[model samples]
Target: QASLADLDILRRTRRMEYFRIVNWDNMLYPQYEDKMQKTIAPDIWKWLQSEAKRKLAEKPVAHPAVRAHWQSIVDGIVPFGYNVVEE
Candidate 1:
């Protein structure tokens, strides 16, 4: 159950990771560069800056499951260097 839930969230947010990686000026795989740049990169710069900050500000709540999931979400964006509250 936990694995499925984690995979689902990863599936949803995988594009965000790609955007971060691409913006890092790294050489992304040639196959994905065209589509990622032409299509996804168009609006991702603006959205990623805002949404990534918002996600980092999110705090885990009282419920264990919710906290765990929230941590997973937070972990995905940790590389982007948002100012997360240290727990």
Candidate 2:
């Protein structure tokens, strides 16, 4: 996961918190301590993001300051999925 704290665009972004869901029914996520299992699900995540986007769009004003910042830095994001490294 990446943090936007240092990004210039996010300076205007609100201090809002959001959530995401990972369907761990199949063990998709890295095994966490037993106490946190079943706490990840995709449906829950989509709902939260949907609400955020809806709230942002409902207001007829400039984006939530952080939106532009996220768009501005989209290309700089690098995926770290595991892959073979050739010598």
Candidate with maximal TM-score? 2
Show where candidate 1 strays beyond 4 Å. 1-42, 60-87
TM-score on alpha carbons, each prediction:
0.24, 0.29
Q: What is the TM-score of candidate 2? A: 0.29
Q: What is the C-alpha lDDT of each candidate?
A: 0.48, 0.43
Instruction: For residues 25-75, write the lDDT of model 2, one tens digit per residue.
Output: 646445554434334344444444565456555654656565643333343
Displacement of residue 34 (Cα, Å) in model 1 is 3.7
- Angstrom error of the Cα, residue 29, model 2: value is 21
